[model samples]
Target: KSPQCTPDQHLQTQSETQGLESAQVTKPVEETLSSLSALLISATANPENVLIDALDRKVAFLVNFLLMKYRMKELVRKADIWKMIIQDDEDHFHEIFLRACEHMEMIFGLDVKEVDPTRHCYGISIKLGLTYDGMMHPPEGLPKTGLLILILAEIFMNDNCVSEEEVWKVLSKTKIYSGQMHFIYGHPKELVTKYLVMEKYLEYRQVADSDPARYEFLWGPRAHAEVRKMEILEFLARVHGTEPQSYPSQYEDALRDEE
Candidate 1:
């Protein structure tokens, strides 16, 4: 592994980053970020090698692609990536999405539980390309969170039938029964957003949402409690199914300790 001092040191981070046309340097970094994402596609895939410290697996992914750009092979060479993506991981789904975010920037647009205690989750989404059979996908390595995909699919479906305003209104509706219903299903608060409500109430309300020009924290996290009432035991069971039992709920607890 490379030294964790790229911010302060002037050395090439990896072989992929070592040589490049000045114009193509960013390409290698991006490719390195995309390699090794294929490891997450199967039941046998290993993520332990993905992130070891602060360094993201994207480093490996980017390097792999940078090394093989001329070969023209697909990112997920065996199974169609889209098919794997559509099959949701019901537990630790957010954990999966965070992995994808390292390789793909597009997935970075959706919301989840934020690390900050003071922050409330917000609703946000974006889809690039207007093809009719358009697929919503994350960067090469990101695992899809079932909840995020459901929200995107619903919104995408709505795009074909209703105005964006109508879609947003319906998805953002907060009902009196929301708490009661949380016993069986997780509330959609973190995954769905009321842009108007978010803009008016959250502290960073004025910050621009993601777009071409800015590094936006487009999505935010919402605890099940903020928008639902499930027992903690159920929550623990679901998250642990996807998370390693060895360090289960580490990220979830990070949210609490930050409090």
Candidate 2:
């Protein structure tokens, strides 16, 4: 003899039964998580293993390749996978990743296009260009960092050597007045000491006989490696309205030497 049950009461009973069955089904999966974690710990315990190390390095390489080939936003759809795979601090990952890119660029001439400018996807470094006349030019509409560095470099192009104090004096005399007495902050001498010297845009050498603070700066490896003599000569020709063939004797010699 069963009591009559309303439709609502029957539905509630059914729901409760379904919940119990679902929990029972999930119980094994929940229990296995701890075991899975322990197994993972055991697998990764010997980080020095050749295979494990190889796999770790390969994973890092692949991650960099993907980031370079595809826009970051497109690749980040699987952020969870990245989080687990990277397993390092974001800054560390980026530092290694950049070094990997720079290495590839140096060895294989491979450039990474990680961003779609119109799509608002990724951040990229803007390259500063030096015109033939040795003008430090950024792309249009960007803040100007001045041509003091480039001008200094150009003046010393032939011998490619100068003292820091001499450069500072020249820079101090040179003025850029776009507005009412807007001065360039930070002495050029200090800028050379702090950044250019370390970046290898300019090579600095000091001898025991020389002044302690006085270091001679010359064009660094990067200057020769990146800036072609032909390009500079071409720019000069354009600026001066002369044929590339009839350039200055020094520039002509440079071109021939480079060739």
Q: Largest lDDT belongs to which candidate?
A: 2
Q: Which ranges in model 1 have alpha carbons more than 4 Å from their true place?
A: 1-33, 42-100, 106-124, 127-133, 136-259
Residue by residue across 130-243, what tens digits does model 2's lDDT show?
322111222222212223233333433323344444444333333312222322223344445545555555566662255444455566665556555565455444434566
lDDT of 1 by residue, 46-112 (tens): 6574434222333333223322321232233212222333233335334444554433332222222
Per-residue lDDT, model 1, residue 17, is: 26
Native-to-model Cα distance after best TM-score fit, residue 40 in candidate 1, in Å: 2.4
Q: Indicate the TM-score of model 2.
A: 0.36
Window of ten residues with lowest summed lDDT in model 2: 133-142
